[model samples]
Target: MTALAALVDFWDEEIDRWVSGHAGVSDRLQPWFESYRGRGHGEVRLDAFPEPYTGRLIGNSTPVVMLGLNPGAAVPRFQAPGGVFFEQLKTLRYSEWAATVPYASKEWESIAGPNRFYQNRFAFARRLLGEPNWSIANGVYFELYPYHSSGVNASMEPPGDVIREFVLDPIGDLDTQHVFAFGKPWFSVPARIGLPPGRVLSAKWEIPSREARIYSLPSGQDLIVMAQNGYAGPPGAGDTEALARAIGLR
Candidate 1:
């Protein structure tokens, strides 16, 4: 499918589940929530509800999907200032946004590029794989939370399962070789509501023997989950260098 079609499908499936109170995007937000008109002035603030995936899908084929908790508030050039609409926000496809950023766009064909809390992981990955073997140009980035969150503790849990179902299922539908899910689950299994909360498990929790933080979801697709915070070495869960060597599929 075309990237826009894939993006629309993702939004349709995910928005329906998360915004359970409403049938779909509120009529008032239809124009703004669906798409931003053009690149806006000032650094784009991606901190809005239901942010879209960022990064280009080479030939509409994204080999890797970097999963995180949510979009933190930022004044980065990678995004457009038109991101928010009546508290709701929309993000241009990352393939478009990355091209604008200085280095993220480097080697990667994006509208722009940027990151830090997110970049360290990529840098670490580059340390192991080097060049296009594992670059943003060959991957996509997204957070598990459908909405924005400056910190991990800010979001609620009820919608997490639905988020996981819509988002992860789509990635599974893709020919994705790896899905690096950063951070831990916010809720425990069989939450108070009796439903399993949405959670990305760390690799260490899956296998006691492996000194790494990467595991395979039931889909048979390799999913590299990190600690609640994506860190490497020491206080972090696993070393990206080791993960690079261990990622046999790539």
Candidate 2:
């Protein structure tokens, strides 16, 4: 079978298993399944939790940069802007994206909406062009809090094998142009998945009035790292612009 068919089969079987694990799940889940299946283009796919994901994040387009965060159910872990986004390019499987993982709106609602990370990135894109039309590698699999992949939480780490089993295996064969890690917390996960080695930049783009030199890397790969420290600047904040300017894109 083709990869798409295999993905669908695997997703359906996995959902069935998850549904069977709970009482009265079939009754609760059938309606959702029907609704998703009814959509043409197979546009809708089932998240690991078997939730309805309307975003078309699985195709053959590669991402320019990737953003990641620790898995928590408190905030929006996977929110992309509207309009002709990129293709899924590849797929990754992790239990945190599944329904079995505990999710709550408390953290999900806290940040990442109109004025949070989503808007921040949107603004950055707008500044580059007039409108913001881009995709982000938002579906993150927390190292420790695998189930809570939406909000913020504190944990040392989880085993590497768990990460490999759920996330790494899925996107192992995918290709991407560049990987932009959002913060230090997630700097290591993308590389761990064998995507690319995204380099860390500085967050000192504040009003320093000092001439900060733009250090260019030898390779033209254009990998970058930024922090989401609530700064009222750019997506990567000063760091993002610095990288952009360094790459001569700004």
Candidate 3:
């Protein structure tokens, strides 16, 4: 099968096994505070608690890749956790220009509606092009930590194997032109991999972004590491400009 097909297979058939140890999580989500006690602040064993990679596989036509941190309350661990979204993925799996399976809103959300990140990413994309049409513009939208969670935090580095297989490998093969990692969590991979070993040119960029610099891989794809935190939390209310400026979309 193709790389994209392999990714889908991993999410569909292989991902749901995270709930094996728990009784009712398969039926309904078990709160992280209840079952897996320390997940929020501790290590997430990828081999045992494998969370499927969320987000749509909206084909490989677009030029850029927007990588997020991880899912929030909306995209529960299981993509088809027995609900309307599950049925959505069932239909979306066959089509190319669609697949908002993990989009929390609904299937065809990307095709039929405004995407989750489009409006958020406008802080910069807007300046590049007025009233940015984020719709299906990026080739792939995913997270570095694809493991499902209830807003939990993993270590600086997750299992290398998981990264190599699900993230790095797929990105290497995909039609990726530029990779924009949103937050510190998503940006850590580049350091661990030890690429160009340089600093960003922009001095005005904030903390995490101030530390981040752009690098290119052998695949001829540019990997941009931003130094700012993700567009999350209360402070994030003002993070739009910093994010845009940090990534040079400003």
In terms of TM-score, the best-performing candidate is: 3
Model 2 clashing-pair count: 19
Local distance difference test values of all predictions, in order: 0.44, 0.35, 0.48
Q: Candidate 1 or 2, higher TM-score?
A: 1
TM-score of every prediction relative to native: 0.54, 0.44, 0.62
Residues forming the 10-long window of minimal summed lDDT in candidate 2: 81-90
lDDT of 2 by residue, 44-149 (tens): 2233333322112345364233334432232223422110110111122322233221222233344432335444554464443323454333321212222223
- Considering every candidate listed, which one attains the maximal lDDT? 3
Which RMSD does model 1 reach against the true structure? 9.3
Q: Higher-lDDT candidate among 2 and 3?
A: 3
* 10 residues in a row with least lDDT, candidate 3: 27-36
Per-residue accuracy of model 3 over 20-90 as CA lDDT, tens digit each: 33312332222221333325434333323333344345354644555665543333333334544444444
Quote model 2's TM-score. 0.44
Question: Which runs in model 1 stand beyond 4 Å of their true positions?
Answer: 1-7, 10-49, 74-114, 128-134, 155-161, 186-215, 228-238, 246-250
Model 2 stretches with alpha carbons more than 4 Å out = 1-16, 19-55, 60-65, 70-117, 124-146, 149-151, 164-175, 188-204, 207-223, 228-239
Q: In candidate 1, what are the lDDT values of residues 27-75, reduced to their tens digit?
A: 5334333332212232223333355565553344645566655555543
> How well does candidate 2 score on lDDT at residue 149?
34
- Flag the better candidate by lDDT, 1 or 2: 1
